[model samples]
Target: MLNLNRNSHVPWISAFLLIISYSIANGVYLTIERVTYYPIFKSDFTSILLTIIAASFMTFYNYKRYVYLIPLSLLSFLLTSITPLILLLPIAYELRKISSIVGISLLITSSSMLSWVFLRLIANVNTYFSLPLMLITAGVPVLIPIVWFIGIFFLFMPNKKGNKDSISLNPLIPFILTLLVSLLPYLPYINPYKFPETVDFKYYYSWLLHPQFDGWFFYTRPFYLILLYLLSLIFKPYPVAFYEFVFLSVFYVYSGYKLASALDRSIASLAALLASVSPMLITFLYSGLEANLFSISLMFLSMYYLIKKEKITLAIILSLLSMLSHIYAWAQISTAIILYYVFRFMVSKIKPSKYEVIYLSSSLPFIFTGLLLIFMGIFPVPMSLANYNDLIYQIAVGSWGSSNMLLFFIITMLGNRFMKNLLGFIYAISVLGTLVIQPATNLIIDLPLFIPAAYALRYIRKDIAILLIINLVLWGIYMSINSVPKIH
Candidate 1:
């Protein structure tokens, strides 16, 4: 059995430290406006050294449990937040424990160092920015909570549990079909060239070279990238990509089924399958942000299990795992929980904690800053906001966002979807659209409004899945459009 007493608070403590370090190293304060450039502590290598010392202390002190490594990895994220930080200390510490640790560390360190160095040395070396990229990097984290709150408020509407349901046996076929169709973008095409060195595959290669790759780009952290790489290896060729997509879709379906089952037992697996393979799920799977999909599904599943079993520890574990997938996942999952209680509190006329709002809003700056750093590399790409605005305009009109708007409108009129739900969806669509407004105005005035608006929208749509889908479609259009020109 796990030693709960010995490491009861370790997880939360680690989570807190991870949040703090992440905020400091990659907060939104750095990204949107470029208020600063140089790191408070320059060489990232030393950060690694310090992180190692810190993790080592925790490991030695908490010998019975591996939870020490949790905070340690969180700290490591801080160390490698800016530049390529040598990870000898982390590597050594991991080696002493798990065998897979060394390989994972190597993959992580090498991918990051090589990517950054390649960006600096090979791709476009000699370019330098006047100030730090803090403002832009900070925007994403800041924006996450804003949007999450909006979703929570929306989801907090009137709904009671239904009757129980039975699970179906043959639900996998449609799930697989829906997933395969969603992955049409990543397939290889026939090349006219003998070596296939050159072809009219403009759409295929353009996104790979988008100049604004970092602005709202997915796969920023090396861990995420490595996950993609390993998933690629395990599943490989192009069809394997379908596996991750299908599996996550399956999880989402199961979660939805379990949820409906709680209310009405006769619920057909079709209900779950439909929810799982919706346009939203397909969109997220294609965008390369698996964590959002995973977390949302887990959060719902956690809620279902929590209600069924009423076990706090299990719920906490599920919640923490969701957080581990992506910090934003924590915000959405936690906000949903709070909103659920808030609704009940309102109904019961119970006093609520004032600090809840404050705590949830705190992580915004950090997520934004992290995103900014990933995009445009060391900050300040050659392209201006005006250039990006035009790009967004072109892509928006021709592709995903507009397409979603049409679909949404159609569903609203024909499907009998609730206006509140429509509002929630629109709010989500707008927050993502906020990315295009980057070059048009200064963030000081705009960010304040945008942040709250995101929250407001989230309040209107507690379903993270809905928000994630809108965002994914936005990302796909951006990538597909941006990548198109490069293939030539």
Candidate 2:
């Protein structure tokens, strides 16, 4: 058993770190075992138990005592090297000894060195999504868990006195930094000048030039392509699609900044800067998920404006456009809104505001018109809805490919619990709804991950946040460059 004081921030950080350690390990374990069928929630619960025991052993710093966990740890071998932050474990531990600017500079220096080593030895061959060192690789094997798990705690345990956010009064400093840092990781990925040969891109390109997508009804979504078509009259479809990725990438960070600024102006830019280089946006950009990007960005903006409460009209319009843009976004937004509203009502006994009622009411006519169009054969119904009987008989499986977002999701979900305000509830709902709709798959969960990362930054001093984001960016660069396309 572990010594859990049940006081202060340990419980919350523990919950978050538990997810971080377990998910990385468990995801890898399943991959190594190559199991076809496993209980999702049950296995996750087991990991939680195992992780608690592991963390207890490390917190006590007893090597002889931790020897017992080795057998169990070896059984879960795949989680050895998680994020680059794990690689920084020994260095972060040393931060306890040297807490000066020069010491932190040395930390940054060491981070770069490790990143280069990884790129040369591990990332060059592209063996796995995480660090390549396995459990039995070399040296003291138990030391792997000790250093990595303890480092997870050390990353958050910043010195209390210097913990205030040190964001510049001028927002441009952070904005320019975010842009520059954001640009670095994306440089290698700029290889595809235009859309390459892929199954979906072909139809998307044709739809931009043609008036009717006659056979693509079941699989095609027209509104986003229609927007591209109008844009293409002036520019080429490829360029239009290309720039949309760029616009949404920046906008994703901006939305987080706006939402974060509303809560804590001090760390808003820090949050935005961190969000800028996260893996989700880059992964989607390279995979060419333009509609998903557009709709999700709008949905986040809608969430942001709704929280502002003064821009209700803009919120409604963006919400409507989110539905128009993609079915997946609609599923995500609608599910999240309903749950969020219910939580607010249950907690405060408050009903939806006037603008909220109006927003829901306005969507009705558009919804009816679309259904009526489908009924009249003007537009075909989705294949899933049309072929419900066949779908109902088949097994439903959930998949997640962007291994880059794994750590981001872990941090976001747990950090959200510390938030008791609007940003907390909405994005927490966003995280939950994402899992409900598509698992923690980074499908609808990408933009939502940024807020909590930024939100978590509010507690840390400026210097520490910079250190964290730098380490994260270095990790993200390795992941993005070595990544594969999410969709075929």
- Best of the candidates, TM-score: 2
> On residues 1-488, what C-alpha lDDT tens digit does candidate 1 reach at each position?
33334433333333223323333444322110101222332334544444444444445446555445535455564445522122222323332222332233324433443343334333533122201121112212322323233443544454333211222336564355444444333334211121111121221123323323233333322233345455555655243333454466667766766654543334334344445334344334324345566666666566565545455566556655555455444443454445544565687775535433333234334435534653546433233433443432322221222112222221222121112332233334333433444422111111112112222222232332233333323322222212211223
Instruction: Give the lowest summed-lDDT range of ten residues in model 2.
Output: 133-142
Root-mean-square deviation of every model: 24.7, 10.1
Q: lDDT of each model, Cα atoms only?
A: 0.36, 0.48
Error of model 1, residue 99, in angstroms: 66
Off by over 4 Å in 2: 1-110, 113-162, 166-203, 211-221, 360-401, 426-447, 461-463, 479-488
TM-score of 1: 0.36
Candidate 1 local Cα displacement, residue 148, angstroms? 15
